[model samples]
Target: MAEESGGHATTLGVRVEAARREAAGVTSYVLTAPDGAELPRWSPGAHVDVHLPSGTVRQYSLCGDPADRRSYRIAVLEQPAGRGGSVEVHRELRPGAAVQIGLPRSNFELVPARRYVFVAGGIGITPVLPMIRQVAASGIEWELVYGARTHGHFAFLGELAAHGDRVRTVPQDTAGVIDLDKLARGAAGAAVFCCGPAPLMDALVDAMAAAGHAGQVHLERFGPVATPVRDAAADDASGPEFVVELTRSGITVPVPRDVSVLDAVRGAGVDIPSSCEMGICGTCETTVLEGEVDHRDDLYTEAERATCGAMLVCVSRACGRKLVLDA
Candidate 1:
């Protein structure tokens, strides 16, 4: 087994034990800690940061049973327009390849509720799948509404089908669009967990809200939306670089224009916990001890953004060229 790192450390070295093709363009990787040791135990909805070549690091959720401590399993869809991370993992990474992984983090966790409803679209099933499995294993009442562009694009159909009546697959080509109104009706006291394309999530949120089920909804975003061009006046070229003090480590890192505060801190080997690398997952959220953050993520609500004191590190720049983080 690989040497176990200290308790809940931010980063650890792991090795690829195996990789196999799962579908047309998806592959699953089995990662084991160094020396083939047991990996850190993680819960449902947890994800890890995968360091790919070209310095492109991406996050993928653990798709297998969290109780299985021997290794972690992650499935990757080779997006055509990807920044070469998934493709490189599929083509170049081989067994025994070493990679750095961040500790498991989760914002889309399952909360205790009377019942559960899971909605997944295409690759978004990566996180929702394990949650469904855990709910099923625990004998909790749950149902899955999975959608894909086509039947061929759907993963885990066999397992889902084996569940008989509990899971429903909606292929867009065959089933048209998912009827959120029907799905949300009579769903009171049931927590709804959804992960899918933004449009689908938006529809679900709107439909649930109209059906009076908004309070039971939870979502996770996988990427960032394109930001509009900032007004010229908002650009301050004369602003001086600010210092971000890490509260836990007592380290101060300079936030330069060329690099984000996240990059500066990570460059110093201080793991601030991030994923998506795109301001979406809210994984690298840290409290603001001082300074304003030009919040850039779409995940947090306006009120939550103001009250949480947390900021997404992927694309959010410091409002004053420097921001203090509770690292």
Candidate 2:
């Protein structure tokens, strides 16, 4: 998800113009300006941070046409066992209800490529929907492998049906899980974009790597990438504690093995606005004045890391014994 820039947060008041069931336990919402004005421009693969009336904030991908500025459409999957945001969206948000939304931002940008392959699972299809539309409109060669728990759980079938054979639906209940190996083999020279559950993404990553197409694969994740659990034995051998200097705050703190850089900064009474403390959200991003970063986040691209100027403080640590941050 995107971050609030400059630590200043602003929300636009938008009214729920329409709501309809797209699939089982999933609802599509169309939000528009109350005064019928044009909303902020957003490209494909963008998402808005929705601030629910119940005081919960959640990010939902904008799946509507990028050309449309009158309204933004997003789909929500009711997750009973997960956070309350989805629950409130499903049960409370309705037509005529007012909502606060942040500006649309995209982390998963679709770069120009010769061909594209999209793989989506469950609600993860939302981000890929608009991407497929863009690629198809450009007359570019593209295909989609969308999967869900059941046939009824798949959304946007009517919209995607016009593409015919270009789109493949795999209902896991009827068919088994999507064969990533087969897809990977077929996606030899294509740029593969995937968004789904962690396991599904992990499988795609492994498959793409095995097919020697890892560099062409791009993904969008709602949560942090899973890291291995470090036991005491692992921490003992992890290495020496690093020192982090907050340039703006003028404080130097020792980041111990047991704590993260984010926690260390907060412990020193310096507040850095953050959400999704796991490093998936770009909220806690800090400028690296000096020192290499042991990037543990999946947000930054290789080019961004090459600059060695920015790092996600939530999970990323210092590569050397000493580091400086432009807090």
Give all TM-scores, in the order shown.
0.81, 0.86
Per-candidate local distance difference test: 0.80, 0.87
Candidate 1, residue 314: lDDT:
64
| Per-residue lDDT of candidate 1, residues 1-327 (tens digit) | 222435436667888889876656777788887776677888888888776766667888888888888889888888869777787777766888988877787878889887999999887888987888888888989988888888888886776877888888899998987888899995788999998888888889888999988999998767655578876566565343567888888888887766776898898779865656677777677789888877878777789888888788766667775677878
Q: Which stretches of candidate 1 lie over 4 Å from their true place?
A: 1-8, 225-275, 282-287, 299-310, 317-322, 325-327
Tell me the tens digit of each residue's lDDT in model 2 across 155-227: 9899999999999999999999999999998998899999989999999999999998899999988787777
lDDT of predicted model 2: 0.87
Residue-level lDDT for 29 in candidate 1: 84
